[model samples]
Target: MTTLPTLTLRDGLTMPQLGFGVFQVPDDQAQQAVESALEAGYRSIDTAMIYGNEHGVGRALAASGIAREDLFVTTKLWIDDHGRGAARPALEASLERLGLASVDLYLIHWPAPATDVYLQTWQGFEDLRAAGLTRGIGVSNFLPEHLDRVVGLGGAVPAVNQIELHPALQNRETVAANAALGIATEAWSPLAQGAVLGEAPVVEAAAAHGVSAAQVVLRWHLQHGNIVIPKSVTPARIAANLDVLDFTLSEAEMAAIDALDRGQRTGPHPAEFNG
Candidate 1:
């Protein structure tokens, strides 16, 4: 089994650069998929309360027999739970569903600027971190403006900001902002939900490396220093996604894929969401 490379967070915690994501994974299949991923050498698992499969994920983790200390579990608090009052209970519920005493990382799932309470929510996360319920805390789908507000208000800076990033939507501005703030950038749709796998750059790179187009894209993300969580229910794909560390993409090829960014997003915009 290939050992995935690790990225260091601002707070000095190490995260597996490539992890398994359980977004859109059906409730019934989530456990089996996660078990397969763990058996395939995945130590990091990304789930959320909104995904509605944290229980399944918990089952898989318990069944894997891997020590809790060896696993890095990450879960998110949903938009509806984005306030100081709602934050702690939401995290507790997530921990209950995950069947874990504490999560390695906790995140505010979305900023939902219309609600305008991330500061309070962040304070809740800070409280959770201080209480030792979560090893580290962060946010997701937050924009540059959100980051600025958090910093300007003297709130806790997130260790990471998970977002919709792929070859089609690189989010250069967000990347720069996070880099400046020492926040690690996580790529949620690193493979574009498999939408960009057929692009010429990806396909050609795959052929050159004798690997799948999906691997090429994932490798591209790794080279760019984005924490990538590419999801797959198939055993072979799940195993293959973690086999990216042995190969490297050239600068020219990386540049070609970099040019493929069109600034399009498949998910919702953070600004207009109310919850």
Candidate 2:
């Protein structure tokens, strides 16, 4: 099994820098996909309530034969589960669905800026962390404004902030803000949903490094110090994604990819996602 590099969160929790994501995966197929990923040396699994595949993921984890301490499992609290009263039960439900005693990380799935309830949702996460139900609690799809509110609470802080990030949507401001507060940033849609896999810069970098374009993109995230969860159902791709730690990209090559940023987005704006 290949060993991926690890990153430490704000609360001193360490996570594999590269993990497997189960987005858009069907409920029935999640188990098989996760099984393949585990065999390919992925110890971290990222899922969400909205994904509706936690049960299948749980089944795979149960059968992985890997000890509980050896794995890092993360699930999110969906928009509907936001606020003080709803967050605890939702997390318990997620654990029930995952068939785990506790999740390594739990996140607020969205800011839901229109609803203005994320502050209360974050409070719930703080409570969960205090109670030890979740090792670490954080938020996803949160911009600087949302994060600032959490910080203002004073009792607890977000350990990680998962968000959509790729060459197209660099999120430099958010990254800076997270760094400033000692919060770790994790990248979802790290490959831009495969949109830039064939781009000239990424292809050239991959060719020079003797790796795949997908690996090149993932390496970019690692080099930038962001935790990344890249999803692939294909066995070869799953193995290939974890094979990036063996090589290094030159500063010039990394710069080329950085310059390719257009500020274009492949997902919905965080502020606009009501759900």
Collision count for each candidate, in order: 0, 0
The residue pairs that clash in candidate 2, if any, are none
Q: Which ten residues in a row have the lowest lDDT in candidate 2?
A: 1-10
Full-model lDDT for every candidate: 0.92, 0.91
lDDT of 1 by residue, 76-155 (tens): 99988888889889999999999999999999899988878899999888999999999999999989999999888686
Stretches of candidate 2 above 4 Å error?
none
- Runs of candidate 1 with Cα error greater than 4 angstroms are none
Model 1, position 270, has a per-residue lDDT of: 78
lDDT of candidate 2 over 144-251, digit per residue (tens)? 988898899886888889999998889999999999999999999999988888889999998898888999999999999999999988988988899888888899
What TM-score does structure 1 among the candidates reach? 0.98
